[model samples]
Structures are given as structure tokens and as C-alpha cells.
Target: MRAELLKPGVRPREVWAWAAFDFANSGYTTVVLTAVFNAYFVSVVAGDADWATFVWTCVIALSNAASLLAMPVIGAVADARAEKKKWLFAMTVLCIAATAGLAFAGPGTIVWASLMIVLSNLAYNVGETLNSAFLPEIAPESSLGKVSGWGWAFGYCGGLVTLGASLLVVTQGESFGLTFDQCVAGTMLITAFVFALASTPLFLWLKERSVPRVNAGSSTDSSGTITGAVAESFREVTRTLKALPRYRDFATLALCGFLYQCGVSVVITLSAVYASAVMGFETADTIFMVFLVNITAAIGAFLFGYVQDAIGHKRALAITLLVWLAMIVVACLAETRGMFWAAANLAGLAMGSSQSAGRAMVGVLAPKARLAEFYSFWNMALWVAAIVGPLSYGAVTWMTGNDHRMAIAVTGLFFAAALLALMPLNLDRGRRAAEAAD
Candidate 1:
């Protein structure tokens, strides 16, 4: 770690810029993935509840799987070239463009809607990986947890704003002489605008600090073709995977992350659907519920961030997972809207805490030289969970005639398995190992 980054005098502007990226992209997650567009895709676009759920899961799973393969290579290449910021900029532009394109999707445009979402989501995940790679460079190890929490906390605020705006548009579109479909499409455009406009601070203020590492065998040839670069990236990823066993604590943490995120992924991706299908929430009600959750989520991220730094990363994560477990049970058993709302609040707290703690732990456990590569693996775990969680929920729902409660109960098992995986994690030993590697 650099002396200046370790000192209390680290630039506030740089930290804010880094945090701003989270604020920027979170609009997409709030509007497109979680709150507005997803329900629109299912009910209006696809026009079939069960089939829409299946298609939604398939889109999420396929895009996540594709990104899972691409991220490690992208991270390896960025780390070798010391170009995290460059890649981040490119991915951000793609995400914004794809999100903007969603405005063209309307009734009977299911295929177009799915394609746009997949592309935008893929770019968003890539950008997320690159953005997290900057953490160690921007903040000291001592405050990494706080910084990570602040980013997520800021992100929830962004989500809250975008969701609130979408709710207004969704509810009032007809009064303004627009159809419901037009209003939904317009919300997508607003999300893209929010993402692009808010992300400017990151591009303007955050500097890339990692130096390029050009190995003789890995450097591009005089022809300037990316073929060699691509090959080198795959080789680097392979080398890192092979070396994982040597970093026992980091590897264990990765497994724990993968397991817990399965449940987390299901909760975030399908909570709206659950409200609609299981609890009979209309579009406005679902959006309002998500808006409420975002408020509490911001508070949780802000508070639990310091909790992780004060106690320890693993302990904080364990506590959050327990919260998730309880919430899942509550959600499954809830017979009324108010009961589900209670579960959503708990989900909000666990959601923020788990993400903040997981990111901080990865920053703490990874050797600085391979920070991007490690975060790539961190993304892989989440993507893998993305695959299993949604697909399982979809499969169970489809087979059981849209019985979402049973599928939700299955999600709780993922959390329980994750807690068991965390039993052996030793944060102090992991920190020592990372420092030794440095």
C-alpha cells in the first residue's frame, strides 16, 4: 500500500469519485433489474406470468454465465495493462447505451427487451469488477471497510432516487397522455441518463495508480493485434486458479461468498416477482416496496460498514447471513402484505451488510498485485450464484405451478450452507497471508 493512501490525508475527492460510480450504475439495477422493467417484461412484454419468470431467469443466468467467463480475462488483461479505468470507461458507455436502447422495447418486444437487458447487465457487471479493483489504490487497509460501505450506501440512495422517479412515471404516465408501455420505456431512458450523468465524477477525478506489468511472454507483438493479449489473459487466469489452494483463506472466503450470494442473487432478482405473483402486489405497490427497502438498505450499509472495520470482516458477514436466513423464513411464511414488508426491511439490512463486508474482505485478503484478478474471482462467485439461484427458483416455480414460497424456502438453504462455509474462515490469518504475499 502507498504511504499517502495509508495516511489519514487521502484525497476526499478521489474517494467520492470512486463512490460515485456506484451511485451511477445503481440506477440500472434499481429500475431495470429489480423494480420497474423486470415486472414490465414479465407481465406486459411477455404477457404470461409463468413463462415470463422462466424467461427472466434464463436471461439473467445466460448473461451472468457469459460475464463469468469474460470477467477474469478482462481483469487479467486490465491488471497487466494497468488500465482498469480505461476498461471501466468502455464498459460504462456500453451499459449506458444498452440501457438507453431499452426505451424502444414495448408490447410484443420481448426478444428486444431481453437482448437489451443482457447486454446492459453484462456491461454493468464488468464495470462493477473494474470499479471494485480501484479500492485498494484509493483507500488504506484500515478504512477499506468504511469506504466499501459508503459506496454501497451511496448506491442505495441512487437506487432510491431512480426507483422513486420510475414510480412517479409509472403511476402518472397516462395522465400525461402517454400509454403505460410508453411510460415504462421512458423510465429506461431515464435510468440510462442517470447512469451516464452521475458517473462523470468518477471519470473526471479518479486516477489509475497501478503500473503496467508487461512480461516478455505476455506483451503484444508489433502488429498490435489483441490475439496475444487475449491468450496471455487466459493464461494469467489459469495461473491464478491453480494458485488458489496456496491462499487457503482467500479461497475459503470465495466459496463462502459463492454460496451466500446464491440466496442474495435470488432475493434481489426475484423479490419483485415474488411480490407480484405470490403476494398479489400491483406494479405501483412493488415499486413502492423496493423504494422503501432502498431507504433501509442505505442505513444498513452505512452502519454495518463501520461494524465490519471495528469487529472483523468474517464476523460481520456471519451476522448478516444470519439476518438473511431469518428474512427468508419470514418471507416464505408471510400471509399478508405487511408481513412481507417486514421481511423486505430485514432483507434490506442484510443486503447492504453482506455486500459491504464481502467486498472489504476481498480487499483485505487479496495481495495488492493481483487485486483486479481477485475481484474478478469475487464477481465469478456472485455470477455463479446468479446462475443457480434464479434458475432454481424458476424451475421450482414452473414445476410447482408458480409456488414461489417453496422456491424461496430453497433460497434459505443457500444462506444456511453459506454460514457453514464461513465457520472455518480466519480473518487475521488471511490478512497475515495477504501481507506476506505482498
Candidate 2:
């Protein structure tokens, strides 16, 4: 089946160009959202309010909610116009500008910090969706698993590289005659610069394979104007949502993705918080730890790409999901910092593999003609998960008197539910459904 789906014309450099966007954007999440800025927001920007953590989660949730609303519309519009690359670039620009805006936020600037986070994160999430939508258009079906894993591996390496740089600035900037404030701001500007520099190859090299759509989702002629196309896109999104169940495997897999992705989101967004608030790790310790974990994550993503194809996507994702469960248990049981560190590295392994597998599953399952629209739905699931997972953690910690152990334990439910759902997913049927649609 994959042999038949395989096509020529995918250049290795083009593939790398696509992957470099992942590399480009990793610094934003790693430095701003995950490591430096989040902790800074809670402790400094919010003046150490008891509600600071919850408020930070609120900002994240709000941004994801915005992404959830706008992603499908944006995808549909880009699909109709065959302007995905343009939209991607626009979002990237917005994110970079917003990230730079964050540099100016300081103590007693809660609203300023919140606003920047919302804008930057919203751009980041939408841009990520657009990037995922490119996979089916680029990689042949036979290479989907490998290429998807390859992209994730690149992404982790990007995280490591950017985080490594941030670590140096944080640790050595004082010696270089930079104040703490300047170092933090410098890191943000550096991330913005790296994102722009790394993504240049993508714009220059990765060709847009999708032609203009006749459907309202893509073509302005169908709707008669860009505004009309936008309106039609909203309608198409509605229709698509109602139509999902007809493709049982795709729908089921999306559901499973929604569930597990929630767990993944929590892990990514809150791990640093947990490290600091629970395990007593400082900024430097968390950065260094996450740096090491990114190494493990890259290895896991690269090695598991072959394993995914050798076994199957479903089985590969299952293995990763189970690992997530084990990771949670380890985190919960850890009485010492060293034990918690083990759990974090275990999480790194699961994080990259599961995400790669999930991505490949979508690439294989989405209809050839409506790749962007379908990916938008999947991306919506991820945004929704982003909101639900981390927000729930915040709520749990808030209600439980900041018991991070309990918060993390609750996150395991998402993965467990996804595992149960995976048992019934028919990947072959899903692939056939996609082909039939095409």
C-alpha cells in the first residue's frame, strides 16, 4: 500500500527545510514558555502572589483557546488560497514580535506579561498547526513515519541548542557585564533572531504542493472574495466537524490524540514548574536538566522512527503512552530530587516518540485533497488539550494547596484514557478511508 502511495520529487534538502521550522520555533517554547519566562512571570511579574501559578496557567489556556477558534479558519483559508507558507510566515512574525514584547515585561506588569504570552503563544500554536499540515504534501506515505520522527528529532535538537545558549547567557552573562534583566531580555531577542534565521531556508526551499482549492475552504472565486472565503471557511469547519465520525479511524485517532496530547501538553508546560515548586530545583538546575532531557528526547525520536515503521504506528504510540504512565508513577513516588530527575528523562523519551507517532498517524490518515483542513482538526485537538491539560494541573494545584504530586498524578488519566482508545483504532481502515476520500 505504501509502495503505491510513494512518489518521487521529495528532495532531502526540502525535507530539512521543512524540519528547520521546527528547529526555528523550539527556542520560543523552550526559553519563553517552558523554562525562563514562566517562572519569572510567577515569581517576579506577579509579585509572588499565591495565585500566580494559576494565573500563568490562565494565560496559557487563553492563548490555546484563541488557537482553537482561529486554527481551522486559518487552515481553511490557507488551504483555499494555497497560501500556507504565507500564513505560516505571518504567524511566525507575530510570534517573534510578541516574544520580543515579553522582554519589556517586569515586576508589577502582570497584564503586560499576560498580553504578550497570549499573543505569542497563539501565534506559536497556529504556526505549529500550519507546519504539521505540510507533512502529507511533502513526504510520501511510505516515509511518513520516518519523516515525522525525523522532524521531531530535529525539533528536540533545536530545543537543546536554544536552551544550551539560554543556559550560557543565564549562567555567564553576569560575568560578561550584563545585568540579570538584560540577560533575560537578551535571551528573548536571541530566540527571535534564531527563529528568523532558521526558518529562512524553509521559505526559500520548501515548495507549496497544494494548489488553490475550488472549495470555499481555499478558493476566493468560490466565495467571491477573501472575506467571503473566511466566512465560508467557518462554515466548512462546521461541516467538517459534523462529518468526522464517518471516518471512524480518523475520528478515533483524533480523539486518542486529544487525550494523550493533553498529557503531553501538561508535561511540556508544567514540568519546569513542578521541578521548581516541588523538587526545589532553581532556574539553572531546571534548564540544565531539561537540556539533558532534550538529548534523550532527540535519541528517542530518531531511534523510534524506525521502530514505528518496523512495528506499526499504533503499537509504537502504545509503547510511548505506557512509558508516560510509568513516568507519572515515578514522579509521584520520587521522595528525592534524583528520583524525580529520572522520571523527567523518562518523560522526555515518551514525549518525542509519542508526538512523532501521533504526527505520522495524522499524515497517513488525512485525505490527500484536504490535508490542511484535516490537520486543522487535529491541531484543534492539540490546542484544546493544551488548555485542558495544563489548566487542570493549575486548578489541581490551586485546590490541593499546591500539591504538585497530586496535579501530576491527575495528568496520568489523560494518557491512560488514550491507551484504552488506541486498542480499538484501525490504522489500516483509516488509511483506506483517507485514500477513498482522496
Candidate 3:
């Protein structure tokens, strides 16, 4: 195997351990967000209410919105005290618990389910931001694409394992005299267990590398009180926002990420719904399809990392965006089941490469000292996409009298616009600015 380019004091095992968190966390996202729980929430838990899809989007969007205000602050705290692992662990535990909590929801439990989603998704988002901050600490700048791609490709494998396991449980539960609902609930508990078990390596091996500062904006003192840290987090955020113009390419990248990720969020949150509602897929078929798509996504994520490094992050991302637009067009026009499958697989390829490329761009753009804090803003962008994308899909579906294909067609604009926005992002300028900051 080729050796990875890592920073001083960073071990390959430590990097692997860091990547393992993606493996652990993918279970929650694959099972809870994309493949199973979303469909379950709409068709089963909500008892097929005409408004279930809209309600699901509203609850998740509200959850994303609520957490949006707190993300930068959380990032600042982690940076202030080198507390990324601490916060990451806390969030991981809470998300696992909250995912398990989802198992308890059934008919007449809409409020219960929504509450769990808010709690779990918030924790998941925060933990993800913290986890990503470790990338710049561990990998060299030149190899960011491959390293990020490694994590993403590895993560999709994790998702595949968890999804495959969940599929077995879900498909077999009914044979054991369990209702479909009980089968799905059982999968949640299974996902939680796997998530907890797989993540143990991260805590044992990943070390915090940041030196503490009271505030990243101005303070040099490392021993300041937590209250002061919290107060300065806000100030630092303000400073960053005002100074964003200084890093024009990074700002532009964030905007493009926001727009593209909105489309991604729609796919993540609503694809299962679309499969069942528009394409007539059963729960098993949907899970299996997701499983297959994940395989392609893993391949794309792995191969495209080298591509990103070779062609540049901007070019690599633009290629993926083209794939995304193609996926959207194919899906919008698809009538037969086989045609839809081709589109979904295309989406899977774009999904994996685009996300990894975007993340690596952030790592390139962010200064070393402010990894967590800068990545927090990136996380914030994702949450904004989460809110806008799914809600827009839901709105279009509602307004068009449940015409889901039209909703998907409208979703294509996000990718188109993002590609246009990405064309002007100058990576060399961004990298020079980031090195200066460091």
C-alpha cells in the first residue's frame, strides 16, 4: 500500500483511528437520515398523513436552524482549549443515545420523533465539525485531497457495513414474528451499538494538537476562564465575518458549498421518500438500492481524491457538479425503474466526490491555527443547506400537488448555480492567504 503523507507526530494508526469515527458515524446517517428512518417517519410513524413529508422537513429544518446559531460558538470553544475530542466524544454519545431514542417512536409519537431528530442531528452536526477539524492537523496540505478522500471513501464503507447489517435485520425481523415497525426499531438499536463500538478507536488514538487560546481573534492567554472563552467566541466570529472579504476564494467556496450541499441535503433527506412515493420501492428495495449506491459512492470517493489532487480541487469539483447536474436531469426525466437506478448511481458518484472535494478545499483554505473555528463556519453552511434544501423540496412537492419529479427538477438549479459559482474560485490565492495566516 502507498504511504500516506501525514504531519509530524501523526501516526498512520492515529489517522486510521480518526477515520474510524467516520465509519462509526455513518451508521447513524445511513440508517437514520437517508435510507430507513426517513421513510419510516413518513409512512409508518406519521401514519401516512398527507402532511408527513412537509412536517418532516419542517422539523429537521427547524432543528438545523436552531443548531446553526450555536455551531460557531462550539467551534470557538474547541479551538480555545483544544477540546475537539472532548466535544466530539460528548456529541457522539448524545447522538448514539438520541438515535436509539428514535426506536421508541411509533404511531401517535410525532412529537417524540421530532424531538429525537433535533437532539440527535444537532449532536451529529457538531461532532462532525469537530472530527473534520482534525484533518488539517493530521494531513499535509498537498495531500489533503487524498486524505480527505480516504476518510470519505472509508466512511462510505462504514455506511455500507451498517446499512448491510440493518438491511439484514430489517428484512429478517418480520420472519421472526416482528412487525415491520419493530424490525426497523431494532435496526436503530443495532446502529447505535455499532456506532458506539466502532468509535472507541478514535478516543484511544486521536490526540488534540491545538494550543489553547482564550480567544482566537485577539487573546494570547491560554488559561483564561471558560466564561471569557465563550464571550470571545462571539467576537471571533464577528471578526471572521467582517474579515471574510480578505479570503475571497474561501468565501466563494463556502457559498458554492452551501448551494451544492443544499441539493445534497435534499437527496439525503428525501431520496427514500421519493423512491417510495414516486418510484414504488419497498423498504427492502430502498435499503438495497442505497447499499448498492454506497458501493459506487465509495469507489468514486476513493478514485476522485487522486483526481482532485491532479486536476486541482476546483476542476475536480466542477467535474462532480457536472455529474450532479446530469444525475438530476436523468432522474427528472426517468420513467422506468431501471432508468431511475442509473440516475441514483450517478448521484452516488457525484455525492461522494463532491463532498470530499469541498471538504478538502476548506482544509486548504483554513489556517492551521483556526481549524476548528473555520470548519465550524463550513458546518454552518451545511446546516443552512440542510434547512433550505429539504424545505424547498418539500415546498415544491406540496405546491405542485405531490409532483415529486418536478420537485427534483427544481433541485437541479442548486447544482447548476453552484457550478457557476465555483468557476471563479482561485485556489492559489486562497492557499497563499491561508499560509500567511498560519
lDDT of 2 at 74: 83
TM-score of each: 0.96, 0.96, 0.96
> What lDDT score belongs to each candidate, Candidate 1 first?
0.87, 0.86, 0.88
**Number of backbone-clashing residue pairs for each candidate, in the order shown:** 0, 1, 0
Cα deviation of 184, candidate 2, in Å: 1.9
| Model 3: per-residue Cα lDDT at residue 39 | 92
**Cα lDDT tens digits for candidate 1, 1-438:** 244534355577878888889999998988888888877788888886567898888999988988988887678678877889989999999999999999998778878888998899999999998999888887888888888998999999889878888889989989999988888888898899889988999999888889887572345435545767767767767877887876788889999999999998888788888988889898889889999999999999999988988988888999999999999989989999899999999999999889889998999899988899888988888899899989998888899998889999988999999999999988788888888888
lDDT of 1 at 338: 92
Off by over 4 Å in 3: 1-4, 214-230
lDDT, candidate 2, residue 277? Answer: 87
Which pairs of residues collide in candidate 3? none
Pairs that collide in candidate 2 are 80-218
TM-score of 2: 0.96
lDDT of 2 by residue, 313-349 (tens): 9999999999999999999999898999899899989
